[model samples]
Structure formats: structure tokens, C-alpha cells
Target: MSSQPVQGLPILPGSTFRDPTKTAFHRSQTLSYKNGFAFKQTPTVGIGGTRLYVNQLSQAELDELSNKRPTLTYGQPKQAPPSDFIPAHVAFDKKVLKFDGYFQEDVPISTEEHFRIRQVGIYYYLEDDSMSVMEPIVENSGMPQGKLIKRQRLPKNDCGDHYHWKDLNRGINITIYGKTFRIVDCDAFTETFLQSQGIELNPPEKMIFDPYTELRNMPLRMYVTPSDFDQLKQFLTFDRMVSLGFVALVLHRILSQRTFPSCVLEISDQEVLEWFTSKDFAVGKSTTLLGRSFFIYNCDEFTRQYYQDKFGITDFQPVNIKKQPPEEIKQIIPPYNGYGFLEDSLQNCFSLIPQPPRKNIIKMLENDRKVLRYAVRLESPRPEDEKRQFILSYCLATDMISIYEPPVRNSGIIGGKFLGKTRVPKPGSSTENPVYYEPSDFTVGAMVEVFSHRFIIVDVDEYVMNYIEHNLESFPASVVESMRNHFAPRKAAKEALKK
Candidate 1:
């Protein structure tokens, strides 16, 4: 047959077996004026195709779509009163009666399979009186499972009557397709429905597990050990005032945490009042609370007094706190760079201005003109320089050192002001930190080096000797002892002359 449309008829060149049109085209499908769909869907048939698409319409569905009613043969259909014609099944659509059941399967091949009990869930729809059975999918069960019975009306036997929701009850046997399922328990709706029907169901039964299943679900043996944790150092370092583990019971969420403390207490007020005030909480008594243990070795004096007054309990030993780590000392002030005194360096660190360090005005006023003087002889290669005398004066107020030479008779050397007043650092001192000479360095028999010339101190003035004796505490012990030794014989000679 050629695939082409008939000429001027608006009919298609296809016909189904039910509605055929003289082997050419169906005339009923060609009626464009009948308000039918203008564009007809073409069938998915190609050249030399063997299979055809079948329309999945039943005779009842076709009759309903065509608005045709079945002819009544059994005495005229009786019409009930409109008030009593209420349909219940339609109103309870999708309501299903669920049950827990299991069936025993016989395995003849293996010893363990001689009896296998497989648990299943059964559901019966109330509206349609249809039922379905489902076997729970087990991991690596090595058996095909799930949907053992699809939802459909099942026959009571080989008869026309099907299984109804009324036939299902807990702790009963439901045989579908020759396999019997023992219903153990049912859901709430099923129980309520059964009771409404005046049928008392058997008490819910537990599922029977075979030996293999029970062995598989058995819990394994285990050994647990307490964990070792250290936080005393951290506790002492961060919050030193936390007296004991009791502090953590309040602040550290001790009730919620799962760690093993010495003794743990819940945060509830009732439990606190019941457990905390007992004699078990007294000093020297050990008590275990929640999951931890605590020893009340000691309490504060106030707490001890309260316990003594209230409970007549005494004898509290002190708790050892040596485990608390020492407080770490941080470097608060930076090191001195040796450019100036420590106070001058500290003042500079605070401000950007390069100001002079604050002076001691009282000390400057008291010792402005006070100077320590010593007679010195310069060591030179020329023999005449050995007799030359030099005076080295150290000013106490400004820490300035000056040198002067006395005019000698018949000496070729002119000696007015030998060295101007300036701070003289010791030989090999850095220029950045010129360590000026101080009064402690001006002593009789001491050596002074200036401008590459070495001079030996020959003597000091009477005022200098008196000052050194008065301020022996300021000098080194060796220098003080030597000065004391030199004055001892003089003091003895003065006493002998008086005698």
C-alpha cells in the first residue's frame, strides 16, 4: 500500500483495526468541521518496520470516552435515597492498613537454610480492597527481595471474592499466592478500624528471628580505657584565680562535655541541692558524682567555718598547689642601647623629640663649684719632664675633667691651661658613648692618660683626702680599705701625742 493522503477528502492514509475506512483512510478522523484537533499526530512507523504501536484503551475506557452507557439487563437499576447514597470508599481514598509480618522459607539444600524467616511489611488499601507485600531490602542478603506482591485485588482462594481490608488483623495468618505470612503487628489505623468492626485482635507478637539472624545482630565485646589529658598548665596560665575543678563545673560547661574529670556534677538546681550539700562533700571525704571522682581535701577558711558552724564538721587539710606553673614574666621594657643612661633611653621611647634628659637641679646647686684635684707627673722620654707637675681637676656637678701645669723655673715648657674642661672618656672608649671621668676615678696614686700622654697621680689636696674619707661607702671595698689603712697610723700618732 502506498502511504499518501486521499485527494480533496482531508482524510489521512492510516487506519486502526477498530476503526477502518475502506482500506484507504478513516473518514471520521478527516472531519475538520467537527471541532476535532486540526493537526493529527502521525504514527512512528518507518519503512520496513515490523512492530506497530498499540493503543492501550480497554472497552470500558473507550465506552466512557465516547459517552456511551452500558445497557441494563438485570431488573431496572434501583436508585437509593439521595441522603443515604453517600459513598465511603471514595472518601477514604489512599488510606492503607499497614502490618508487620514475616514468613518462613524452607531451604532444602544447606543446613543453615533448613528454616529461614524473612520479615516483610504488608499494606492493604481501604478504598480499593487491594493489598501489597514488601520484603525489606537487606545489604548483601544474597537474595532477591522487595515487592513480593504488587498492589492488586487478590482472590481469597480460586474463587471470585478478593481479599478485603476487613480480612486483615494483627497476629493472624494471611496466605497470598500459596505463601502464608504471619501478621505480627499493625499500625494505629488498622487497629482502630479492627476495633470499630467489633473484632478484638490478638496481642501484637514479636518477629521470630532465626539463629543466623540473632547471631548476626549480637553486639561484639569491647574493652574501653580512660583517656589521659593535661590542661593544668593551661588553666594556671590563663586563669590563675580558678581555685579547683569546681570552677570548671560552672564556667567550662562541665555538665555537657563528655570528658572524665575528677568529679562531675550536673547543672540542674534540684540535683545540685540534693547532692552538693551532703556530708560526702566534706573535706577529706572522696565522692564520685556523675562520671567523675572528687576529693574534698581542703576548703577555704570561710567555707570551713561555715561547715563547722552548720554541720559541726572540722579537720580540713590544705590542698597542694605546687602543680600550678609559675607566672611567665614578659619583657616590659626594652634593653638600653648604651647611648645614654637607662632613664634617658626610657624617656626617648615615649616621645619623638630629642630633648635633653632632666637634670637634678638640687644636686647641681649643691656641688656646682665642688671639684676633686690631684697632682700628677707626666712620663716622657726626656729626663726633665719627670719633675713637671700637672693638676687634674674633676668637676662633680658636670662630670668634666681639666688638666693644668704649674710654671716651673728654668723650664722650656710653657704651661698655662694644659687641657680645656671637657668630659674625658677612658682610653679605647667609643666616641658614641664617651664615658666621662667621675669623682670616683680621681684618687691619689691613680694613673690618668690624656692626649696620648700618661701621667701618674702623685698626691691629692687636703680637701680631696677629707672627701674620700667621708664618702668611703661610694668607693670599691679595696679602695676604701686602702684609704682606711693610710689614716689608721695618723690617727694612732695623734692619740699618742695627746697622751
Candidate 2:
């Protein structure tokens, strides 16, 4: 047969050979070792007769190569979960945003001495979205491809008085980052997902539980300014990736660095006298327990015992009594009833700075100095016109800005509950300021320290009314008059216009 080049054979391109025998192998190796006939060195042949001839790769050979493949170590970075992981509380409040309004309640007292009987509750949407104040650790286990949606479950308890919206559809279904969660079924998942997220399922044994804790689980009254309202809203939407555990963190920031200490003892001359004379002495025995820190002398048996157990009796005793104080009791100060205030302070103070590994005390102080609002004063009465200064400053600074109308003034103290149709004591009046009562032990709402100025609005009604009436009253008289006019004109027509 006439010589004809194998038609389908891949032409052996010219190549320099280390050895002509090896040249065929080199060509095959470059082609990942395709089976082919080997060539031998021959200096006389054109370019030393080295050539490649293809052959079928057998199934058995392919199987052996596949089995011998080397293991690969993949090195890829991890990714985090989708961004819209919102808490249930936040979603519900946002869903019911439009239903907020002013509401008042009437409370009847069966006392021989009676006063203004109106119990006021101002209703409005305050953002209650549960959100993580702390940012989550971005890790690779979760895929970030999808969106996030938050669901809020309604309270199972009789939260009617505290909740503004009590409709059947009280639950919230919200979309965030392309994921949707049903809140009614959410708390159940807290045990699982939260655990996976590094949260321990069991509360620590040392997590002091008081028999009276149930008593203290009262509804917290909150008053928010327009500025604060805006802040809370921003925290809910943009910061939805945060978890519920972080709320404590946010609260700690507000509580820790507020401009005012948690408690203030404005002692009157009589209070100082009562302290020395009373069997169970107190410097300001009758002073309202309004703020968080409460004082108990070492004399009380129950309190002393409690402290002894918590901090050990020797540590609880005078400092000189111990050789080396137990570190636990050295800082074993009882958890203040107002501990929430301190936690809130720390939470809020930290919020102003950026994320984790909290700033050192010096750095925090430096930042506070730059942002002076968080610097609440902690002080004792000074010799220079202390009482007079305190009263005047309190009058000017306290959030209670309502002009005292005589009947309301006569019946109750500034922050006291109002009894219907009764006279209130005048400021600086001789008569003891009528004993004010709380329907519930007061709760701190939100505290803000701006510059060196600090104001905390605990209950919404008085603070909101005071701020709005004073700050926003400059609208045109014509506008105000027209609004009133529209409402007063034939009821049906006005109603129709509203509809």
C-alpha cells in the first residue's frame, strides 16, 4: 500500500527532545498522557524520528486513573446569613404604625379622701420591634442569596392594657432581605436557632431569681421624643439583622452614660432628722423611690442575710474586718432594683461607639468628653444653696412641663396620678405635696443625654404633651382655627370629609 499519513492522527509538531524516547512521552504528558505509540531516537531521520500515534484509552485504564486521583484541599471563604433577620416585637409595631392616637382611662379609688379620678393613658405607636442591638458575627455557613422577612407573634397573655392594637390580625408578617418568617410560630424556634447561633439554652444557675420578681415584672412606661422616635425607627429597619439578645446591649448603652445618675437623694431637713430617730433609719425615708438605685442599711436582717449569702458575711462586713476580701463580695453590691437603669445606661453609651470588644474606660471617657450628652452628673448636695438650686433646676429640667392648673395641682404631685376634680398643691406651698400614687411601679421608658444636657421621659402622656405644646405651638393661628372650624361645622359633613 502506498504510504499515507494516518488521517486522524494528531500531527507531532516539531519539538526539542531531552531524549527522542522521552519526546513521545512529553507530547503525551502535555496532552495529559493520552495513550499513543512511543518513538525512538534516530539522529539520521528528519528531526530524529520522534512521532506520536494515538490509541484508544481503555475503560480499565481510565478506571485505574480515576481511582488514583489525588485528593484536593479546597480553600474557599465562608459567607453569612441573609441580612433581614428581624425580631417579632419590631415587626408588629411597624405593621400597626397608623393606629396610634391619644387615649385616656378613668380609675376609681375608694378612699375616704377623694381627688381627680382621671387615669390617663396616651396611645400612639412607639416602635417596639425586637431587634438585636449587637451585630451578628458574619460567618460562612449561611448563604446570603435570599431576602429576609420578619414575623411578630401577638402576646399570649392578657396584654390588652399594654398593647395598642388588639385585632385578630395582631400578628405581623414582614419581608426583609427576601425571607419571610411567621412570628406566631417563632418563640419555639428560639430554642433551636438561637442555640445554634451560640446562645445557651439554660439560664445560668447563678442568675439570681427573686420571689418578688413577678411583682417587678410590671409594664415599663415609655416616653419618646420626635427625635428619639426617628432614631428607634431607623434602628428597626436598617438594623434588622440584629437579634433580640442585643436589646439588652442597646439598653445598657442608654443606661450607663446618661447625664443623670439612676437615683437622686434630694434630702429635706426633716428627712435628715427622721434618719437618726427612726428605729429602722433611712436618710431620706420618705423620699420617692422614683429612680433605680435604692438604699438599704446593713441593719435590716433580711437585707443583711441576703447580702451575706450573695457576697459572704465577712465580705458584707466592714472592709477592715477581712484579710483579703473575696473578690465576689468586694463587688458584691446587691443588684439594684434600678439595675435596669444601669443596664440601660451601659447599653446606650456603648451604642454611640462602634461594634464589640467594648472600648477601654479611658477611651470611653474620651469619647464621652467629645460627646458630652452621655455625661450625667452623679453628685451629693453641695453647700452652696443646694436645696434652692435643686428645686429650681428640677422645675426647669424635669420632663414634667405641664402648667399646673389649680384643681389638678391641688389634688396631686407633679408626677402623681390625678384624682378627678381636685385641687393640687401650689409649688413651694406650705401644705405637704399630696401623696402621689403609682398605678404600677414606674418603669423607665427611654433616656437620652444630648450634649451635657440630659432628659429622660418615662411616661409618654405628660412628657409628650409638654414637649409638643411648648415646642410645636408656633403653627399659624389661621391654620389652627380652620382645623377647629372644620370639626365644628355640621357633624355629618365633617364626618363625611374625614371619610
Candidate 3:
């Protein structure tokens, strides 16, 4: 195929022009033409290979070539739209302090994706010295004008393909076929970068940085919206404020509210007034507007059932919503949009709901109530039986090993079978002694059995085992038993080979 001629204008490859033949190529890319100045022509394909050469030019083409080129070479492409602006939608709920309007868009044909910001203004109220003051603030509507910088599109599934934008100090980056594109522009989000440098967002400003290497991976979290919150009102607890579980639950409720718009009383307009008057939502008696515990359980009973089904849990009840005293309700729950009284019978039971226990990290880790086994170096050198005796002695001294579970393969065998670096014996029992094993098997996240107790390995790996072998003197029976699994299969296989 012949190389297309460059338009009479200065031509760069891959650029489209109305008249390609009149395009003038750089002298480096062309041979001398009839006009003496090298002109770009389509490639002439021959058996040898593709080559470019100029033949002749008309008087009109000569006249066009004589014109001087424009000084600006890298201005916006003429084909780009004159003024581009992204469109967006915004909604609000009562619990939301503010919602930022921005989203990411998918890119077709390539691995890259684009980000968009909806240009919108939000008005809200903030407390100032115990007084509610109306505040109007403008958060930039969408991602600043820049290229999609570092990005990676995760493999697509039912949830749709997800991509991450690695925001450089200067601009957002996106990955296209594993290549990073660092967008160069005046407007970029460097909120995290500035914060790391001890800068605050009292006054929002565009981030500025020199384009460097393109990034291919980064994390992106969707900011929670107020409508996403839930109000269970069924379960409330005193310790909820101290434990972050309450807050996370409240955030989940808010997420659910945002996700399901039809059921809840949306607080967008005078609807907040209706919700405040509704029996489902009781202030102070039901929930303090800002109480984390109250917000999480304020949903209707059906909503609670939905959550219970979704999480595969039997106990979705929030606990003790009907136990509040009227006097307590009067003191804590403030009246919004008037109408505080819910009549005689209902008002008699006005109390803040009792919440469930908060699930903290410590509590979660301890809930299983299983035995904890750790390998300890023996104080003195000992033989195999002596080592077991010493380990048992220590366990006896500490009362730590009350139970143990033996492996499928017993010891006292010459060889065993190997599976994924673990040794399994060819079916022996308590009648036979268990085999000794190498220390490499019982690292973190591994499984081991001692006497009767089954243990899930935690915190140490092969590297640590090696370190202990070099640093510590002896391996106790518990560790030895765990390590034995690694070599059990090998021993069995070797026995089979001998047979």
C-alpha cells in the first residue's frame, strides 16, 4: 500500500486531514520533488518493501506549499468540540452533611476509563457555637480536566468491570493495556498529597505537579452518601459510640437507604417533616439525630427482615425499641418540624431503643474460644522422647494443651506420601507412633494437629522456622508434630518404592 500523502499543511502521522496529498511532510520523511522541496506521498509498496518518494506537483500545490506554517503546533485538535461540559445528577437526605457529585466513566475498545465530575453546588447547615448556620459551599463537580492517568480495569464480572484511578500528586492516571498515562493539566486532585504534607482543605485548590512516570494501579473508594444510611430503631446500645461498629452499621444503613429509595421517607424536602411525625421515627425516644446507634436501627421491621435475609443471619432484631420512658424521651429527643406527641398509649413507651452489642476487633478475634498454641524453645537440650516429655511437662506446668487432634498418618514409618509440601502417612493410627517432620510445614495460616487439638497456624512462616532452627536450640513435639506432616507422604511413597 502506498503511504498516504501529507496534506499541504505540516503533517504528523495518524492525524486526519481533508486533503492528505497536499500535506507537506518533514524533509526527513520525503525525497526531493519537482518543486525541489521534498513533499510527502503515499508509500509505494514493492517486492523490496514500502518506500516513500515524491513525483510531481501542480502550480496550486506549489502555491499552497509556499505559505508559512502556524507557530502553535500542539494546540487543541481542531476537531474537538468548542466547549465541553459534563452533566450530572444530585440527591440529598437528612443525615447527609454534603454529597460530592462525581463519578467515573468506562472507556470502550481500550483498557482505560475516564472520570467525570458533575458541576453542581450544595447548600447545607453546620453547627456554629450551638447555633445552626446555613452554609453554602461549592465542591468541584467532577474530576478536573486532565487525561485519565494511572488506571487498571479489574476483570469484569456480574458487578461490572471495576477500574481504579491512581491519582498522582499532579493528575489522575489510567492504565491502557498496562500502560500508564499521566494526564498533564492545570486542574488535578491532590487532596491526599496535600494532606500528607500537612495541608488542610479549608480552601480547595487544584493540585499541581510535573508529569513523571505513569502509574498502573491504585485504590479507589466510593464515598458514602447520606441516603445510604439506615435507621433500625430496634437495637440501640450504650457502647455503640465507643465501638466503630456502630458507625459502620450506620454507614451501611445510609448505603441501604441510598440503594433503595422507594421504602424510606426521603428527607429531601418537607418529607423530613412527615418522617419526623411518623411513628416509625421517634426523636430522642427513637434516636438522637446524630446518635450512631439510633441511626443504624431506625428502619421499619420489613427493612430489618430484608437486612437479615441479605446477611444470612438469624438475629436481625435491633433489641428494645419499646422500653423508653416518656420523661427520658422528652429530655433527649428534640422536636423537628413540630409534633412531638404520639398520643397517650404510644407516648407512654417513648424511650430510646436498646441496641445490640458492638462487635469490636478484639471481641471478633476472641469469639471462637479455641486453644492457642505457640512454639516455645526448650530451656535445655534433650532427645526426641525427652523433648516430648519436656514439651508435655511445660504444657502440664502451664495447663495449656488440654486437647489435641492427631493427623491421618501416624509416625514410626520409614517413608510417607507428599502433597503440596505436606507429608501424609499411608493410614496409621494411635496404635503406631507418629513420624518426625521437618520444621518447614507449620508456618502462618497452616494447619497442624497435636495429641487431640487442631490448630490453625498463625504468624510464622518457613523463614521464621529457619530463623528459629538457627536461633533456638530444639523443636518441641507440638512443632515437630506439625512439621511431620510435610514429610509424611514422602515417607509413605518411599516405603511403596521399596516394596
Point to the candidate with the largest lDDT. Answer: 1
lDDT of each: 0.69, 0.30, 0.35
Q: For model 1, name the residue pairs that clash.
A: 262-293
TM-score of each: 0.28, 0.12, 0.13
Worst 10 residues of 1 by lDDT: 247-256
Arranged by lDDT with the best first, the candidates are: 1, 3, 2
lDDT of 2 by residue, 436-468 (tens): 211121112323232222333222233322333
Tens digit per residue, CA lDDT, model 3, 68-155: 2342444444676677543322221222122122222444554443432222211121121011112123245232433222222332
TM-score of candidate 1 against the unseen true structure? 0.28
RMSD (CA, Å), each prediction: 33.3, 39.3, 34.6
Candidate 3: regions farther than 4 A off: 1-391, 394-397, 401-499
Task: Give residue 217's error in model 2 in angstroms.
Answer: 49
Q: What would the per-residue lDDT of candidate 1 be over residues 1-499, giving only the tens digit for each residue?
A: 5443334455444532232353433223322433665644334443343233456565567777565343343444668766755466977787888999999988888866577899999988877778899999989989999989998989887768888876877878978889999999998988898899898898999888777778778998867564464456545543422223232132111222323336545566462324343344655556665666665555555556655765887766665533467799774656657554545667665677856678878878988899888888998998978788989888878777789998876799888799888767788876545566667765556777785888887766667767777877777777666656656777799999999
Candidate 2: where are CA atoms >4 Å away? 1-11, 14-77, 81-96, 100-126, 129-499
Provide the lDDT at 108 for model 2: 55
lDDT of 3 at 80: 61
Put the candidates in TM-score order, highest first. 1, 3, 2
